[model samples]
Target: MAGVGLVHQGRTRQYEVKVTAYVLFSCFVAAMGGLLFGYDLGITGGVTSMDPFLIKFFPSVYKQMKLEKAHENGPYCRFNNELLTLFTSSLYLAALVASLFASNTTRILGRKTSMFLGGLFFLVGALLNGFAVNVAMLIIGRLLLGFGVGYSNQSVPVYLSEMAPPNIRGALNMGFQMMITIGIFFANLINYLTAAQENGWRYSLGMGAVPALLLCIASLFLGDTPNSMIERGEYGRAKIILHKIRGTQDVDDEFQDLIDVIEVARQVAHPWRNITQPKYRPQLTLCSFIPFFQQLTGINVIMFYAPVLFQSLGFGDDASLMSAVIAVAVNVMATMVSILSVDKFGRRVLFLEGGTQMLLCQVAVGTLIALKFGVKGEGSFTKSEADLLLLFICLFVAAFAWSWGPLSWLVPSEICPLEVRSAGQSINVAVNMLFTFGIAQVFLPMLCYLKFGLFFFFAGFLVMMTIFVALLLPETKNVPIEEMNSVWNSHWFWTKFVPQEVVSDHSSSNCKPSP
Candidate 1:
């Protein structure tokens, strides 16, 4: 009896520790989705600059076509800047297409399989992109890469949310976005280091294959979501997987919870249909538009065209690439700060503060450009003036990284209930891609025609986002996601009794779902 009692005690402690560890472990794995997403964004910036001779580095099939070099009238007087941006935007275009079916893919393939397929696309596409000799081949590669990124971006958050302990879901999901920023930053740094070397850009583009390979390997080890397993009629396996993941010995309560969620989801009708229903409209609105807003902030314009932007500021090619590296470094560091503060500071505070900081930084940048470049003098800002301009741009990227970058996804994941999660996320991701595509197409023309006024436009959007978040968005840190809808619907009633910041406490018996 004494030995049995000690064994039971040891098991209980092990279970306690594993619950947190397993969720975090899953977060680490899911974050590869974000890493690949970032890698796609980073690689394109460097690759686009070397377009004409890029064919020379490719295999024979891809190496045949080259940009028509002009004669003494300056070979390539007008660079195909617009076409290069289109190539960059092609990834988002593919993402838009993939996102339309991403939710269905998740329902059919399950999260693990969907992620695995995403990785497969990433590996194949990265290889094809690296060896592309023509624009058509490169665009096709981008399309494949986009499919991978879109699918992973759509599925990874859902996987993390389903696997996480309710109390820490926000933090874990935010980690996905942080990984994205870090991935982009890392990819840019690699490109900068290799910018002067032969095939440097090609190798940079190929680096996306690494995370895809890692994700493919990791998926083989992770168990499918318990909810997905139960929905697919694999209850016994789900129960066992939940027991292992959550480290619960009895597993009765957790199993029941899973069953209840699966049943609710089953009765919810086609998840996409649920979004148009009255009950889900608010969440649909929040999820879809938040990501849309994040993209509309013109961050991608900076990422895709940073080298061009810096050159317009009077820096030569080397200086422009170096400045981009500095901006990317600042972005990476700011994401680290966001990860540390996400759990402690609360989502609302970060969004509010981050938005405000970006507004100021963007305004400063716009003012500098208006004063320096808008007037046609020496055709550029002076060196010190250029340095100050780069500083503000770095500040803007850093501010965006810390707040909008992570919170956009985290908030959406929390705002929607499990019954409509897959559909809601799909719509959100679709909007994200659409805006990414639209901005990529229009921004260059806007920059060429409207000049400094474009910043004012984005600044106005930021102001609107700030106001919307302050009045309507709820603080979701530490809240049980199942109860979030109810809290949001009756926030006025709850605020009368509970603190405004405390949405739902899992420890309280009263936190049970209403009948």
Candidate 2:
């Protein structure tokens, strides 16, 4: 079979393909993992703010919120109870641990299997959460949901990257992030609708099962990635699936490339140790720091507690819920922008532009809050000031949606060679969950102590991360997944770690016919 050959960074590769409906359907199904994650993120904040839920599960927090409502002093600290925050943070803590185990599950059982397990766990967790009669049941349910998130988050991005064509990988990979924002929007909308109901939080919590079931059913129909099939020694089946996905029988060059990477992968008995080698330093660094920086951007603070933040700013309960819905709506729309332009504009452009926008908005919001509420949290915002605050917050959310939110997942998943892909993604998920847990647990207290200064703190992180990208990260725009080493070799800094000989050998080896 003849294939189209193209040169990138002085390396020539051949892979001809067209986007087909099967590929799109598979990617869409796999991206549902993000919806499960996003729903959890969006739902918790609103549920915590619901009068009935808080009064039932967190009576002390409810009392504190009411006390702050009557008197305007220290409103930022009203939701700062240790137990109250634990309910939100525990899922991430569980996810951090679950991600480690999910690495092996993803590598051995296949991406589809991992996704199925995730959906199953999420389904049970959602049901338990809805029916919980006590704090113990609630925390347990959250733990199960965390397990779901860990497994799905670990595998979904990798699956999407593996299944997508090189030209469209960025956009397809962004599908996960797109679903995340959609999930957030739906959760916030549900919360708004149910906030007035007697058991509204239960409905909000249970609604997570809807997406979970969809993912489970979808996973059953999706094929494992050709890369995973090759890794598991299903060479003939991998080639067949590749032909189907590429919508062409002329897939020899691409199939050979998969075989080459999997051959290298087979030699490394311990993928975790293999990734630690000096040659993989660039991938290792990105896998660790991107997710770390992503969490520090303080997006989750807004995502997990937008309602609480709005309420603290002097909006009433219904108003706060509605504002959260609007914020997530902007998030969903901005993610659509990312989906449309990621492949065309490239990753670094969006990262820098989005970071700059977010930093400015965060600064603007901090300044507004400080001017209106005086850092002691004793004053309240006027209606106009409150509306302005919500506007700035939405802008910040939008900036993050297009840049750090999706790219963080996309870049790490696509950069690693197949040998270390699962391990790298596991590290990505673990770091993301660790910091997410930390922020979820501490955000309220930080808000209380830092007051308006909290925005400045996150703004500082945005500065460092943007600089990090400018100085260190290379453009991974349309690079083939198997040939990512060339991207590093061409970078002025990363080139030092990836020797020319290594990249040349890697490239030459990929052209060899499969055994």
Candidate 3:
């Protein structure tokens, strides 16, 4: 009875500890880097959907495409179609290269400083984009923007995961995704007000600089993550920063845990190479597939071309943009559901449930597209049919928001052992960006040729994703970072889904308790 009471009290305290003001501030600032990514989505997605934007930049192509599509005649250029794809998709290409190199950048410079450099790059890129006079300058600006995106996406998640407590880590790390949706909503709102003006895209694109500037300036006041500090042999400073982050003084045991894991790893000269070893294969596979299937779920297709999708479903241009605002707004709100429940529910449960629901939503949307719009673009739906199409798209976004969207970032950051975390996370995020580029580059062409078949293509991938999660993924909530090796080693189909006590007892047999 006494032991039970002691255990209960300890669990209560775990949930009761307050996160410090400075720590929360630093997280918000780091998450602003996510906001810049969202701003780019909002600014570019919305601006490109506008007639004035197309008319101004690619006059010849816009005119020709309009003529082909039966819209009123405009100035025509044959080059616009390919250039438009390059204009926006180049960012992801640049981002992929940056992410590939980010493993070394974070290790050498630390998370906080690396993020500051990312923000500075984004700011410069936004300035170039907003003031560009020629096609070459705009493409250069996009390359720079992608480069910063790679750095921010790779560094921020690893930083947040290390800094946050295991209990609340999901919510706090997910703050990055939340800020991203917020940035998108605001970008749409800004573009809605400006999409009709001749030079309004300049303002919409320029506004991306604000969040980048803030994140960079705020990074100056922050300290490095505990993991980074430990790697640098700054034990004393690591403890101080951990104290500041956790808002407590009794960190001796936790600090010891860090020392034990890192010391064992310190012996390996090329720790990053361990990622390919036999024991680590399951973890490496999980890290690869989670992000890979995440993009395959087609949320980016929905997010990046939201207005165009709505317009095809028969909403007017202005109405399509407004609907986009609502779609992203739903995305922000639904993510809060996962944020509140993720820790309580465990990772495997929510991911399983959410992944299944997402598959259903995609299937339903595809069926509706085939029925109402047909395989070709010849027919229009009634008001009720159009409303249902809109509802399904928003439903699909909400499903992704609560599942793969945040978890893609969360699980990768959490599952990697500290020894190779930076390198592993860089590889994972780069895969995400690479797929993002492929999706963004092909979506318009698919819509042009495949017409209604695209949603079905994404739907098939979601089916595979749902099965993948059910068969392989284990619960990661509140698992100690040091014990990830044990978790991966013992991960059978249901090892992690049982009660925590059972999992702990089972995992304990395979590895010695840390001193």
TM-score of each: 0.86, 0.96, 0.90
Clashes of each: 1, 0, 3
By TM-score: ranked, best first = 2, 3, 1
Candidate 2: regions farther than 4 A off = 1-11, 69-73, 504-515
Residue 364 C-alpha lDDT in model 3: 82
The lDDT-based order of candidates, best leading, equals 2, 3, 1
Q: Which stretches of candidate 3 lie over 4 Å from their true place?
A: 1-18, 69-80, 493-515
In terms of TM-score, how similar is model 2 to the real structure? Answer: 0.96
Worst 10 residues of 2 by lDDT: 1-10
Score each candidate by Cα lDDT.
0.73, 0.90, 0.76
lDDT of 3 by residue, 213-316 (tens): 88888889889888788887999999999888877776665676577667766765664687776555665777788889998998887788777667666677
- Best candidate per TM-score, number? 2
Candidate 1 C-alpha lDDT tens digits along 2-89: 1100011112111121444666777798888888988888767666555333445332212221321221211111123456667788
Error of 1 at 342 (Å): 1.9
Stronger candidate by lDDT (1 vs 3): 3
